[model samples]
Target: MRAENTQPVDRTMDIETLMRALLRDVLGLSQDRVDAFDLDTPLFGALPELDSMAVAGLLTEMEDRFAILIEDDDIDGETFETFGTLLAFAEAKAGN
Candidate 1:
């Protein structure tokens, strides 16, 4: 009998994939555009699709998807600055 391989799964991929889906659905972005995003990619003012109107929807979507409550005071410009930052914030909020 061989020993079983045991390793903890990485949750980063799940968060990133979920975020891409949210971005695509909420902001109506193309799969190519969402796929092209990296950790350093700028959001907020940089993305024309992510405007004030879309921000609320995005936040709501995130809250619903992650089952996390995000207070008004919890978000700021920096929170939406990059894909990685948003993922990190969500991970923290989710206690993952």
Candidate 2:
């Protein structure tokens, strides 16, 4: 397995800010709701809109926005169980 990257991003880049942006842009959630979410909150369980189609949209968004490649077999429900888990997965893919 490859080693995990731990370098920090630019000071202008905030993890929470990036996470909220991802939630809103990729998940089509309003800023209001996105802002109120806890780290452990289950995004799909909390929002009914995140079904199979939403997963496709999310994967597309990740590739476009983060330049993170997600293989077909790389993800399953467990990886998406919570907001923090999903964000961690993205952070790992981003090598950060």
Candidate 3:
């Protein structure tokens, strides 16, 4: 078998980092705070920062950053309820 170290991501950009950038762009939060936020954090209800306008801005930012189109119907609360869920969805969208 080949060595596990042989991979492209090491030389190339990481999707998680890109997702974080998108998050920063959308959420208007610092990178440190974004890193601190975990996978299961209550987004809309608990997080006061995630207002309806902010959510819409985030959706637009994510679509632009990831080079993917998002329909209005795809804007589900569960998708942005946490960092991990959003990362996974972004990964799936970017075909990573």
Candidate 4:
């Protein structure tokens, strides 16, 4: 039998923290707003600041910050339906 090592890998930024920062920076939201974010928090339709234009900017910012490429076809209403969905997409792109 082989023994397995149990060391945790360090990630400079976790998905949730990164997502909150992204929302704050890209949407120009206050820290109070960003701090209230959660997996179930509505994003696209519910948030007044998250319009189509903001979505584009947010995606671009995410690509730059996370060093991940986001394809056109991958974007949709559902992708931004909630914070969780967006985080899932980012996490998948980051191979986390």
Candidate 5:
């Protein structure tokens, strides 16, 4: 019998959902607030809750939940600029 792989697959939708939940949990955002987020939704400067310290916590949660490593050099203003960009960065790191 062949053994099946049990590793988690990083689907686009899954990543999106996870990202939304992460934002809510880490930043103490309301569900409605996060649900309203679309690809073009601005994140960093637009959201007062996502300041520098919150960003650190958010990144740590992202690493834990996504099982990925985020190096200091891997981030820039552009990565957290929008929901799409953040999702793209997560997808790339997750090998989706």
Candidate 6:
């Protein structure tokens, strides 16, 4: 007989904080810049650092940090349209 190991996931982790840190680290944005982002803050086209190439790295980091899998069809322009949209996408993918 073997005992099963069980541990509850920490759902209370603040996704917004994680996102702010991620954006700062991945995109090399200043802490002040990321901290100032509101729900309506534009991302992809509005930020010079968040170009098409950076999107790939951002997606990869999101997957690793959030422990969520993102498929090719799962993303579109709307996903990165704004800070709110990106947060919504992350919350959905993380099952939050």
Q: Go through the candidates in order and give the C-alpha RMSD of each one to the true structure.
A: 3.0, 6.5, 4.5, 4.1, 2.1, 3.9
Candidate 2, residues 66-88, lDDT tens digits: the string is 77789988897777788788877
Positional deviation of residue 83's Cα in model 3 after best superposition, in angstroms: 1.1
Distance (Å) between predicted and true CA of 33, model 4? 1.1
Which lDDT value does model 3 have at 82? 75
Tell me how far candidate 6 lies from the true structure as C-alpha RMSD in angstroms: 3.9
Candidate 5 lDDT over residue span 1-96, tens digit each: 999988657489899999999999999999999999999999999999999999999899999999999999999879999999999999999988
Candidate 6 residue lDDT tens string, 1-96: 998767445543478888889999999999999999999999989999999889999999999999999999999989999998998899889888
Model 3: weakest 10-residue lDDT segment is: 5-14
In model 5, the runs with Cα more than 4 Å from the true position are: 1-10
Pairs clashing in candidate 2? none
Give lDDT tens digits, candidate 1, residues 22-92. Answer: 99999999999999999999999899999999999999999999889999999987899998898889888
**Residue 52 lDDT, candidate 5, scale 0-100:** 96
Q: What's the candidate order when arranged by decreasing TM-score?
A: 5, 1, 6, 4, 2, 3
Q: Name model 1 segments beyond 4 Å from true.
A: 1-8
Top TM-score hit: 5
The TM-score between candidate 6 and the true structure equals: 0.86
Alpha carbon deviation, residue 20, candidate 5 (Å): 0.2
Better of 2 and 3 by TM-score: 2
> What is the descending lDDT order?
5, 6, 1, 4, 2, 3
Can you tell me which runs of candidate 2 are displaced by over 4 Å?
Answer: 1-15
Clashing pairs in 4: none
TM-score of 4: 0.85
Each model's lDDT: 0.90, 0.77, 0.71, 0.87, 0.94, 0.90
